[model samples]
Target chain A: MPDNLQQALGASTNEPTASSKSNLKKLPGDLAMWFFILAELTVFAIFFIGFAIAENLNLVMFAEGKAQLHKVAGLINTIALITSSYFVAISLHSMRVRNDRQAVFRLILALVFAAVYIVIKLWEYESLFEQGIDIETNTFFTLYFLITAFHFMHILLGMVILVYMAKNAYQGKYNDSSSESEFSGFESGACYWHMVDLLWIILFPLIYVI
Target chain B: MMKFWQRYALSWGWLIILTMASVAIGQYFQYATLNSVLFIAIVMLIIALKGQQIVDVFMELKHAPSLWRNIMLSYVIVVPLIITLIYI
Candidate 1:
């Protein structure tokens, strides 16, 4: 296989040393994909700092804007993200056993979670629009829309990647001929999903707790 | 720590605990000038540690060509330090 393709597929050379292949995997592979994760994290951190600055400048507005947010929607998104994280964890576990079908199934469920979050987020946005608030209304709205929209963009990207992984799985790319490591697609997918979840973890407080 | 750290504790456990602690600290103490810098540094460290652990285990950058790993590691360290200097 081509190096680039192999990288996407995330297959290590099938030559597993005795020490390497010895037992159950306790954790997912920590890959360069994490830096991809880190970039998203950095972006969220910037938004968070902006939130802090805004709060200091106008605590009342920040507090009022936060109260305007749909707490139930936010909570649902949190649950979705957490549920998706669980699926990613399961997908990795399935990958360890070389159970390609099970891994793909778990990943698809994660996609469903993402979609659920987006739908509810859209509902929340529309309701806010009806309330005469928007990105240009003030700094708080601007930051709120920007952060959530940026997050939605990431969900879309993750969906695309997960879709590709699922398709490849159905094609038997992970059939018995290959070891689990031979397929890095799911690994990368799961990592990205975790990044999304981590951002939401921060956002939960930024939008609601504060 | 590809093998060693992986053997000790799942890295995510460390990540979750650190993050929760950060959140608690963020909640109790308002962001003062000194506090902001201190918290930011702590957050940066968490991000760095989690990122490095993930790279080592998931990407197997540790198993890839050493030169590639070294080069990327340099970028990882330098980029955040520069970010700190510029932002702070």
Candidate 2:
């Protein structure tokens, strides 16, 4: 019997079943991108650990510094980044399902939320500066500016990548039928953006709240 | 079973809720009842949970190679553990 007729008749064939095919594990994105992500994560982890040690040494000063920070701003930025990540996730899903238009729209939404983060962050920095706080103010401020400014730069770079992906996606450069390498590039950019969000998840509590 | 998009939505919802919950705990419960040590531990645990969701759902690494997924998961677990130790 023909394979199609057998499939229509609900008969098993030699070919792998859908369940088995779904069980085959495959990592998303390019291998190089994963390596880059690991490197970035290691650096951020070092910075975080350093911050914790510094706080341990100057417990009072660190507590005062935390008090000065705008917790509401931090919370809002957390929400913005997480929402941005959600849009990026759905955007990638739409691309995989061949819904290019929805993918592009969702990417735009992601960019907008990311922009909210940037704007609020800059505002927070400006407010701190107005109160005579700078990287050189003290140990706490130094690490605060150092870690957050570094993450801020990553956010800018991630936005640029998102823009590139959105443009390419709108042009139908990535689709369900695209080559593996092409799809990997799109996924790689999305992963990078998510890394930024993940870093902030830890940073907000460590710096502002906890 | 949830569709892929529904799963993403669910993850997003949880991430948002966890973020807000951590903040509330840090703000309200930190002084009201819980000791400083317990408060910090709770916050660290919440941060770890948030990290896990981002890794598995947003980054789509849940079913990736075991080595890669474990590496990401370990970072989330280890970083928070280290922070908790420092505070306590």
What are the Cα lDDT values of the candidates?
0.62, 0.87
Model 2 misplacement above 4 A: A1-18, A21-23, A176-179
Candidate 1 runs further than 4 Å off? A1-32, A176-182, B1-88
- Whole-model lDDT, model 2: 0.87
Give me candidate 1's TM-score against the actual structure. 0.63
Q: lDDT by residue for model 2 over A52-82, one digit each (tens)?
A: 9999999999999999999999999999999
DockQ (0 to 1) for model 2: 0.62
Give TM-scores of chain A for all candidates.
0.82, 0.89
DockQ of each: 0.09, 0.62
RMSD of 1: 6.8
Candidate 1 lDDT, B1-88, residue by residue in tens: 1432242235545545655554556555554435555654555555456446444543345566566456545544544454344335
